[model samples]
Target: MPRAFADITFTDSVKAAQSLYGSRDANRGFELAEDGRHEIGPREAQFISARDSFYQATVGDNGWPYVQHRGGPAGFLKVLDERTIGYADFRGNVQYLSVGNLMGDERVSLILMDYANRRRLKIWGRARIVHEADEPELVARLEDPSYRAPVERGIVITVEAWDWNCPKHITPRYTVPEVEVMLEQLHAEIADLKAQLANR
Candidate 1:
């Protein structure tokens, strides 16, 4: 756990739980995070760039938490800089719950998952919505020319800290593209086997 993440997550209540669970170490967490697991370096930037979808969480004025799934072509989330990331928020069901929640609180949490690779990344950041009128250049940078999803605004998330989760028991799930490649290899093997039998 990075200090940035651990700092916010390791509250007294959480510490009590850790004690109850028989884990009595906090230094290791901080030490490992300091060893370069917490910063948004090139590795993190590349990981975030390849993700097609991510789940964003926000707290509402009513104190309720909401998680919204944001998706686009691979690399929908744009890394503006080492510490900044933004994405074009497309129009959805029009509930506007996320926007409303962000209005009350700028704090945001994001989880980007690569199910096929059994990898997950957690990011803590403060986010603000930027309108086209307010930031046309940013909007253009994040927009996908091929994706026809009508973008309402852009959600700019400024990274405070990020952490990578352990890939324990994360069941591998294949996308259609992945399955197609597997099937192609199977067909090629069958053709090779048939040719060998004919030669015999």
Candidate 2:
């Protein structure tokens, strides 16, 4: 864990819980560590580019935390720079819970998962909502040309800190495309075996 991530996440209550659980000492090392991981690195960029979906959490005016799943084609979430990432907001159920929450509180947290690889990334950031009328070029940049969904707006996040979590207890789950690749390889092997049997 990076110091920046620790700084943002480790509250007094959290520390107290960690102390009760005997993990406080171990976690303190993270706070003292120098690596901040405030900017995206090459490995982070690659992982972020490959993710098709993420869970976004926002705080409502009533103080309730709202979590919503944001998804699109792989790479729909664009990394504008080392410190910025964004996505085009497609029309959904029209509840506008997330958008409304962002208007009230720009602070947001995101959890991106690679279930097949058993990897997860956590991001803390402030978000800005952009309308097409305001920044057409930016909205266009965030949108995926091949995706059929109609985008209503754009959400750009200024990354404050990010951290990769351990894979413990994360069940490996494969996407359809990943399974198809495995099946294709299996079929090729089966054909080769049949050819060998015929030769014999």
Which 10 residues in a row give candidate 2 its minimum summed lDDT? 1-10
Model 1: per-residue Cα lDDT over 1-200, one tens digit each: 34777777778887788888877485446634655444578989999999999999999998999999988999999999988999999888889999999999999999999999999999999999999998899899989898888899999988887888989988999888889999999999999999999999
Candidate 2 TM-score to native? 0.98
The regions of model 2 sitting more than 4 angstroms off are none
In angstroms, give how far residue 88 of model 2 lies from its true place.
0.2
Clashing pairs in 2: none
Candidate 1: Cα lDDT at 147: 89
The residue pairs that clash in candidate 1, if any, are: none
User: Stretches of candidate 1 above 4 Å error?
Assistant: 26-28, 31-33, 36-38
Model 2 error, position 128 (Å): 0.6
Clashes of each: 0, 0
TM-score for every candidate vs. truth?
0.93, 0.98
Worst lDDT run of 10 residues, candidate 1, spans: 30-39
Model 2: C-alpha RMSD to truth? 1.2
- lDDT comparing candidate 1 with the true structure: 0.88
